[model samples]
Target: MTESQPHLLFSFGTLLDRQVQTALFGRTVATTPAALAGYATRPLAITDEAVIATSGQDVHLTLERRLGSTVEGAVLRLTDEELAAADAYEVADYARRQVLLTSGETAWAYLDANPLRSAARIVIVGDSIAYGRCDPQGGWTGHLAAAHIAANETQNRVFNLAVPGSTLADVSAQTPALLPPRHPDTLIVAAGINDSAVPLAAPGDGHDGLAHLTGHLDSLAATARRHNARLVVVGPVWLDETRTGDYEGLRFTTDRALALRTALRAWCADHHIDFLDLWEPLRDQPHLLVDGLHPDAAGHKELHRHLDALG
Candidate 1:
């Protein structure tokens, strides 16, 4: 297809709704009657609040490959921008794939990428905050694990491999655990604060530190890409100046933390990786920190809320 030509997208579900189309594309998309062969429709439950509100339904039809079945739908002509909008509208449960229609036309369709492995396996690695630290319940990762267990029985799995006082180098070394035979569906990295605190011992130390951090982050992203897993980098939270200062003869300041968070956010954006900013959310909440360095039980609960919303 030419760059100027609109892309053809086969819609077998919510995209058929005029309201959903308007909400996603700011206008109704032009569509023609079409049918997809070798696929059958199945009801996929929706948990995202925004998606449910937009489509006006808690469940939507998803395509599954079948031998002798055909799914009736419409072929939507969408611009590049509109196609990206459609992508953002879809939840992680669906992935777009190119397929041939009954009319001998090629179109993109959102399909159930893993029907059998529906449950998600998320692996987390970072520093103390991700390790749950001062929180008696292990922290936000712990809370997320419990919630998933409650909602999906024993199907879902969350692995927390955070280490206390770990840096980007430390987390990068842990990437091998996520490779091959048993790779997770998603990889969450909650580092940067520790690396930010490293004092510049020399004139060029600051520049070197940043370059090293970038290399480590790229390594982590490469590992995730090898397994086709989603990578999410959780930015560092602000520190309380009154209760936190130099540790083990090295200085730790809010300025450095903020700078590192900004860098991490920018890197994630450029690489198309997911980034969750915790700096602003926890900046004014001093009560959530027990030692000014780690989050308390309430703080961990707050973190859980934000991460849960990503689903």
Candidate 2:
């Protein structure tokens, strides 16, 4: 047999976009609303409205039956090129794994893993989420390491370079210098929340919002490209309703965030960079926040759901 033209990807989040599905997976994808065992989902309050997951060390959600409750998704029939494209978007933060589907079938899905390779180092740049704070087991980074080992059945090294209370400028200032040494295969940059939270004065009085935002992004992107590695930019999550109007904590500067999101999306498109806009996915969920800034266990689970769908 020539081969059954590899056709399937179990997705869970924004990669579930119809347009993206068609573009990367050849024709329309075949999807089954599926649940990943051992994980729970939630919304994030910090950066681009995104979801997170909280899965314990040994707990797995038992699928007694194929629950019909579906989260919108499609499983695509993909080619190596298509798979490569999808990998560019996902593999940085996750490793592809074989998953048991609702129908008792199996499909290749991207499972979270430590972003590391003996030959290729992975450097994650973002905020507290990247730092794996609030999560005693080391947040997603720790989860990422476990997932990677489970999927690859091999060891891969990664560094959690996320600095708490640091802004995009701070990361930008630091990343380029380290690239020569780390030589990462993937550079994940999660910006916006902090930037929006701490806005710089209007640029010398003449720059527009778009210009200001893009200017900063341009610098980040240029640095990423110079490193010759894949750059994944995670937009900030939405602000909590309770803290929306207040600038004290976790509340986003709505105006600044919108500007940053638009500009970054455009930048991703123009530069062929991978962008995951998480804000819209978790906007409706008000209870995801554990505090004004971080997401609860439930909130983190949902974020992983979104990442799974990124394929």
By TM-score, the best candidate is 1
lDDT assessment of candidate 1: 0.77
Regions of candidate 2 where Cα sits further than 4 Å from its true position: 1-120, 153-155, 198-211, 244-251
RMSD of each: 7.6, 14.9
TM-score of decoy 2? 0.54
| Model 2: per-residue Cα lDDT at residue 98 | 46
TM-scores, all candidates, are: 0.65, 0.54
The digit string of per-residue lDDT tens for model 2 on 72-109 reads: 34465677777777776552345554444545555556
Lowest-scoring 10 consecutive residues by lDDT in candidate 2? 56-65
lDDT of each: 0.77, 0.57
Which TM-score value belongs to model 1? 0.65
Point out where model 1 deviates above 4 Å: 1-119, 178-182, 200-208, 309-311
lDDT of 2 at 140: 55
